[model samples]
Target: MSWWGKVAGGAFGFMLGGPLGALLGAVLGHSLDKGMKGMEGAEELGPGDRERVQTAFFTTVFSVMGRIAKADGQVSKDEIALAETVMREMDLNVEMRNTAINLFNQGKADDFPLDEVLDQFRRECHRRNTLIQMFIEIQIQAAYADGRMDGAEEQSLLHICRRLGVPEFAFRRLEKMIRAERHYAGAGRGRAAPPPSKPTLNDAYAILNVNADATDAEVKKAYRRLMSQHHPDKLVAKGLPEEMMKMATQKTHEIRQAYEQVKSARGI
Candidate 1:
């Protein structure tokens, strides 16, 4: 059965006990089983509970998204629309979509425990840095959904990175890359494009997260590593939701485009 199947059947919270479990229970209108309350789960997900980390990821994404949307003191139409767009892109089922919306609302609450939630989520992933990086990227994407990030949103994003153990420079790099991606998506090859902001050699470097002075070989290594991390099939095998394949595929496209641009510029 899928993770949602187990969760909806009221069997998820017991095995996946943690802050995530509690959030899921509250959203579902029940108390998570306390058999493992206040205790830590295994560093690695075992065979029987392979769905546990996936559940953690889903719970964190929606709830943290809610808080990020409201970080600027008000939830704008653009932010809300981004949430809906993500749901639509994921092609979520009726049940899953409704649950995600509720989780978003929960995150927007003033009393949302941001630090605790991040701590538990990080633990749940058990040093799976690839998954953690994806989580941060999603939040950054949401914060700038309105085309610009307000000061409060930026601070909130930085705080999220601090709590999640992501570096400040890494966050800044992603910010630039996502901004570039905005134009890159619209400026398809041989199309009437926006200003020549994206696809700039600098932007390409940001997307690949490499220094301008890096050697050609280093650039190729970064490209390959990022592509591997965002590979749709591989991510799904590692417990990323099937509904998220669209996003994973989009990321790979971005990485590939950035790589091509770099290769052309360097005559690689």
Candidate 2:
């Protein structure tokens, strides 16, 4: 599978990792049960449950991407073309791509119930932040796919950055590093090794943008404020290119998880 396929598949695995993580794992025996059924491992799928999962997965993933692409003021043909390339690279049939595009368009529309879709996705996927982040990273890659990223795209992604409980400055710094490396590779420049430790919990407080000794209220406030920025619907409204909704879902999960972690750690 391609890197994009791995990401999508990982999203499902992460989803099952939440509440149903344990049971599903023992039943399926595999981390990602893309084609596997419940414990019995039947080839046949009950139409309703399968359809529901498919809808949730499709809605959430495309919605996130749509939100990212529109992060900038207007959607450009370049972005659209890049999206098509992604679809093609994934080997999604024309029908599947069309469906995805239609969903993407719906997500970008003014009145699409983004919050509702998110809610449904959360309910179905059980809201795993790791899964969400997988989606978000894909959108981030999409936005930076072309050599240059637009101001609107950056702003759009920043809004998502906030929602995911990710610090804008850190993400921007990471983005800068990613772009620089890509540039160097394009220009055949010598490359330096990256820091061994990518972003992790060691920077949790920084990711939350809170003081080490932040009060409970302060922590909640920061989490809420950060999440509000990455709210999937808000990103779409802000004209973030639609491709980054994947990031939005992950951000929402991250926000929730961060809030929980803070509450637990502070015994709030």
Candidate 3:
């Protein structure tokens, strides 16, 4: 069966036991219980398992995003727009879009179980660091939607990283890359006129999480590691949702651009 079908068929029967499952059950209502009987023997981490993980990822992403949005006790218009932008980027169909919206709303609820949801999501990822990292990046993007990561949002992000087993240094590196990307993208859009010099060189190094004076071999290693981590096909096989492949694709593009820029500058 298709991933979506698997997710729909087993989401309730399989997930109804957990906090996230309870939220989904509430949102999906009677429909979630319709196929509970047929969802047996679908627990292996094969294709069906991948679908299940992907579904979990999708659900956890928006829900946690909502939680982060509400961390400041007020969800800004920019944050809402960012959620909408993600929906649009994923190009979710009506049913899936509605599901995402519901999940997001559930996340914003005062009683949302952030720790429980993160624990479940971490288990779903099966120790796949790349997937966890990607999850963090998405949250960071949403946190910065209002042009800065507020104090509450930063605290929330730190908690999330700790739950996901991401180191503080790694999170800092990601933050730098995110900031650089926003700057680079803004420049590309002509949002403001450029100064005499471009920020490409510095931004490139930041994207790679390497210092400007890093050795050639170190730069190559970072590039290769990032490429492997963000490779869309690899991530998909490891349970990244098809709908979210765009994120992996864009990440790879940024890494490639950074590597190219570094190579040109260093005469490599």
Candidate 4:
């Protein structure tokens, strides 16, 4: 079973026993019985700390995504569609899909405890900066799903970055990269005409979080650091859920493309 299936099937309450636990109980309903027996021995052996981090990442991601969706006062059809698209992309099974939708709905509630959830997530991450950055990146992707980040959504993103100890400058840089990514992706689909000019040159630098004027050595250093930070094996060892590895993989692809673009442009 996938980690999410195990999470929903296992007696999460026995291990989590916190707001996240309560939330899972409400979301999973009576579906927990299917895998209960399998969990019995594992529970006696004690929950894996990695399991806790995985659960935390899964729970916090969907809930926080819903919160961001509602930041503009009303969740638009586009936003709803975006959520469904993400579910499809993740290839969630029926049970896990329902649970994810419930988590998203819970996040839209007026009483949703954003701060508490973030605090718990931060604790679970245990200062693993790469995981935290990936978390922020996913949130940013959700915010930009509608093709633009509205004022309310931008404010919510900034608030999230502040709470997560992510610098504002870094947040802005990621925002630019996401926008660039969307544009780049869109331009390649069934279009006979090309954009007046490719933005990849500038976007490449943004993706590496470097300046156009940076030296070749500086660019090389930035590329290596980003690649190291996003290495899937390293992140998985540090407790990134298996389901999220795809996103990390995609990130590395983007970084590599960006680096290649920069290297070509500079003849390096």
Predicted candidate 1 versus true structure: per-residue lDDT over 153-237, tens digit per residue:
9999999989988999988877887777765665322222233454587878888889889999999999999999999887776
- As for TM-score, the candidate ahead, 1 or 2, is 1
For model 1, where is the 10-residue window of minimal lDDT?
187-196
Q: Identify the runs in model 1 with alpha carbons over 4 angstroms from their true place.
A: 30-48, 187-198
CA lDDT, every prediction? 0.80, 0.52, 0.79, 0.76
Q: Tens digit of lDDT per residue, candidate 2, span 15-78?
A: 4333223222333346445433343433123333432343345455665566666766566665
lDDT by residue (tens digit), candidate 4, 108-204: 9999989888877777788888888888887887886666689999999999888888899989878887766654445322222243245568888
User: Global CA lDDT of candidate 2, please?
Assistant: 0.52
Give the winner by TM-score: 1 or 4: 1
Could you give me the TM-score of model 4 versus the true structure?
0.85
Which candidate leads the pack in TM-score?
3
**TM values, all candidates:** 0.86, 0.44, 0.88, 0.85
For model 2, the stretches where C-alpha displacement exceeds 4 angstroms are: 1-55, 119-124, 164-170, 173-268
Q: lDDT (0-100) at residue 182 of candidate 2?
A: 40
Over 4 Å off, model 3:
9-16, 33-48, 187-199
Q: Model 4: runs farther than 4 Å from truth?
A: 12-14, 30-48, 187-198
Clashes of 3: 0
* Superposition-based RMSD of candidate 4 using all C-alpha atoms, in angstroms: 4.4
In candidate 1, which residue pairs get closer than 3 Å at backbone N, Cα or C atoms, i.e. clash?
A: none
**What is the lDDT, from 0 to 100, of the residue 261 in candidate 3?**
92
> How would you order the candidates by TM-score, starting with the best?
3, 1, 4, 2
